[model samples]
Target: MSSSKNMSGGILACENALQRLLEGKPVLSVHVGLDVSKITASIVSLEAGFDRGYLKKSRRAHLPILAKIESVRAEAGKGSNSSSAKKVQRLEDKVLLLEKELAMVRTQRDRVLTQNLQLWERVRELELAERQNKTRQVRLHH
Candidate 1:
């Protein structure tokens, strides 16, 4: 009985910690005696918050709970029985769209960078030619 009580208490503490995290509050791993990384990984697996890239770039300690709540609401809209399946499909579609968009943006960035490099090379060539012309004129006059 005592063991069960302790287990229940631990569970309650975990639940409370999760609640606080969801509320955009800071939760220390030491306070909850839980691995924050594991908890965040589970949240990421559930597709809560933004994409992995955004999360890594932002270096946020916890996932944004608002996104999770919105996702849950969107999933709930399609009935409970098929919600998970539909949500997975929807998320997959979103990933595909984002991937395509990312590819296009990368192509544009590459093109722009190439153009910039070419412009700098042209500028350097022009400067060198002008300097050579000035040197030639100076020698001819002398």
Candidate 2:
């Protein structure tokens, strides 16, 4: 093959590799002796918070990466159930926190309402006293 043809082939291969990497698929090749390419990574197969170092560093990159991972031996039927369990736990925690805050706010509101009622009663009492004192003075003068 001519040099130009060889260069064109190389360019095509590089383009394909870049496309796979951008699509978040590993650059898997038989030459690598693995099912997945080591450079590309996908978060779907990985458990949350497993690769903190890689996550932190690659977070700034524009293209998605695919990482090669070995098939881990997992217990039977354990995968689907554990995800739901985690979601339920997180929601329960949020609900509990909200309930506690609601209760405290209700208590505070009740106290303020009670204080307002007491103030209204005090004002009524003062008005009644003033009327009675004024009537008594008028009768004494007459």
Candidate 3:
């Protein structure tokens, strides 16, 4: 009785990256990491000067589902200073940490549901046994 719900998260950048990669252009460097939920993933786009308009060649990037987050550093001069870069880095780290927490919670919830189902099954078994015992007792008295 475990039905699944279908959903999709659109990533135009990823689609574009894959297309470019397939067209013989190496996938512009990006740190793609699977969200802790493992349900969806995000790829941090890097490499400036990417011509998003160039869509003549469409191809799949074939990037793996769980790509490693190599390194996330603000592009040089993108930030006002190194402190800003550090701040960005910290934010990304926090996001990744939160994702991990979310995944953990999901796993715990699944485990709890399974345990509940088992308990309900046990209750049903006990109820059936009680009913059977009552029938036996009545037959003996008769």
What TM-score does each of the candidates earn? 0.44, 0.43, 0.41
- For candidate 1, write residues 70-135 as lDDT tens digits: 454455454555756877999999999999999999999999999999999999999999999999
List the candidate numbers ranked by TM-score, top first: 1, 2, 3
**Candidate 2 residues 1-142, lDDT tens each?**
5866754544344445544543545344422332222322333222221332333324333122322121211221345377669889999999999999999999999999999999999999999999999999999999
Error of 3 at 42 (Å): 45
Better of 1 and 3 by lDDT: 1
TM-score of 2: 0.43
Residue range with the least summed lDDT across 10 consecutive positions in model 1: 48-57
Question: Model 1 misses residue 25 by how many Å?
Answer: 31
Q: Whole-model lDDT, candidate 3?
A: 0.47
Question: Between 2 and 3, whose lDDT is larger?
Answer: 2
Candidate RMSDs in order? 15.3, 13.1, 20.1
Off by over 4 Å in 3: 1-81
Ranking by lDDT: 1, 2, 3
Q: Give the alpha carbon lDDT tens digit for every residue of 1-142 in model 3.
A: 1211111122344444433433435344432332222211222233112343322223233133123212112222333476578889999999999999999999999999999999999999999999999999999999
